[model samples]
Target: MELLNQIKENAKKANKKIVLPEGTEERTLKATEILLKEGIAQIILLGNPETVKANAASLGVCIDGATIVDPATDSNRDAYADIMVEIRKKKGLTKEKALDMLNDPLCFGPIMIKAGHADGEVAGAINATGDVLRPAFQFVKTLPGMSVVSGAFLMFLKDKTFGHEGVMVFSDCAVMPETNDKQLAEIAVATAKTAKAIVGMDPKVAMLSFSTKGSAKHDVVDKVANATKIAQEMAPEFKIDGELQLDAAIVEEVAALKAPESPVAGKANVLIFPSLEAGNIGYKLVQRLAGAQAVGPVLQGMAAPINDLSRGCSVSDIVNLVAITATQAAG
Candidate 1:
């Protein structure tokens, strides 16, 4: 909570404008109220204006400061549709199809970002991950030199017992089922940047596996090792080491016996898992068992600051994500 407060403070300074596509949902509506009251960011809500107003009124929430756009009736609908046609023309999208797609807020929200109508977008509280991400991939796309978009969680533990005083990053937990060495390297680089920008840490990245510094021999070990090398080559100034087991990466005593020569060993704040299965399982274990606050599966490598929320997220989660998105936009 302390770390989140610091992030919120930083976000407040950014004063970014964030669009919420799931505006009609109760959690989103409630979160918007806090965002407005706190002056966290300029808020835009996408939905039918009448429905949104009615819902907020009944829920005793005030959206006086928010801009509500009814995509169905907004005058910009045609203009946005035209923009989509131009952007997606190479993929065989026609004006008719673009107009149809614009009817959905999922598509419309990202289109708004690409068209410069908003700084960033947040959605998926009531939508699937694909519904939120597919449009972003088509509209916002990836940043320069990035091959794929990945997801990471900023794990904030209560005790400073491990990994950069209890704040660590776990990557590829929500996207990319499988990644090659190059993709893994990209994930490391991107995760490091996220750690610095969002978590306010100088990142020490660990490419994690079941082996420690070539102590075990396997193709999977080699993949992680190669990825570490590529990541180091990509960011020569960043501190990174790899092919380490979880213990060697975060446990000081074990690191001394296993990877004594590695700078990132036992002090790593950013962990890059070799596979999605491992990453997902690892984060959930820490989140559930360790009682750590897992904020995100925040989408990284996008050209803009668009994010996806878990469908089961709470109002607080929505609020925190807005702050994180705002900070990203600021950067």
Candidate 2:
């Protein structure tokens, strides 16, 4: 099925309230339109009201004024500040800092969700990754039973080499800089849950590394092995294995030669990396160099579905992430 179809179906089920920062972008406005027309969400757009209108007019897109939430005109500003101060009382927030954050777009969006004004948020179409994440940590928080917030990419491919055509999830690419065995295990299980929730399938997770099984010896090898053990213990129902190279995890002949006993080898859909460097570089290599359409660095393990978009993302990208965010919120 097409990724957009999955998104539309999820949006119908979730009916989430979504907040968009820097809502004047062509893609952002178009996404807002789709969300409303499809009943996928009730959206709040952030920016100057007139400016948003003018931009939409310039792009030949029209947004209902009632749906746009201008921070400058928001009557709930002080209330939002109070909520932010309350949530970050331990973070050393003073009344002044609280007010400052409430005025900031980054903080305001998540604060809206925390205060029940919105169900989820989608940002980073024109912001940095950290700019997107800082507010999420401050307000949205980690999901219950989850540790630190980590992330993954939903890689969209042209061919259905795997059971599902079009896309598969690969995670921990955006959050963890260098994950230990326990962290990797958490990433695997968390990603599996994310896949199941959004894509509606039990994930076969592959803990990918430079070596397969006992053929290689190093700290990294030990890390993958330990991660495999932890993942099995934490989510035994998930099909998971580790220390397999890329080819071995996804290719049939490689699985036969390298690690024939592994359940996930050659059949894994979600791939976990030992470090952020590898995850980021690996995914980019496939997307840019090896010819695949990479859709996300979707933030996971959060209390709600909050996602970041590339600054250069198109209207379609924003629409897709909003769909993903709605699904996350529904769960």
lDDT to native, each model: 0.91, 0.82
Q: Per model, how many backbone clashes are there?
A: 0, 1
Clashing pairs in 2: 27-315
Best by TM-score: 1
Model 1: per-residue Cα lDDT over 177-250, one tens digit each: 99999999999999999999888789999999999989999999999999999999999878989989999998
- Candidate 2 on 27-70: residue-level lDDT in tens? 88887776777777778888888888889888877677336777
Q: Which regions of candidate 1 deviate over 4 angstroms?
A: none
Error of 1 at 27 (Å): 0.4
Q: If scored against the real structure, what TM-score would every candidate get?
A: 0.98, 0.94
TM-score of 1: 0.98
The true-versus-predicted C-alpha distance at residue 33 of model 2, in Å, is: 2.6
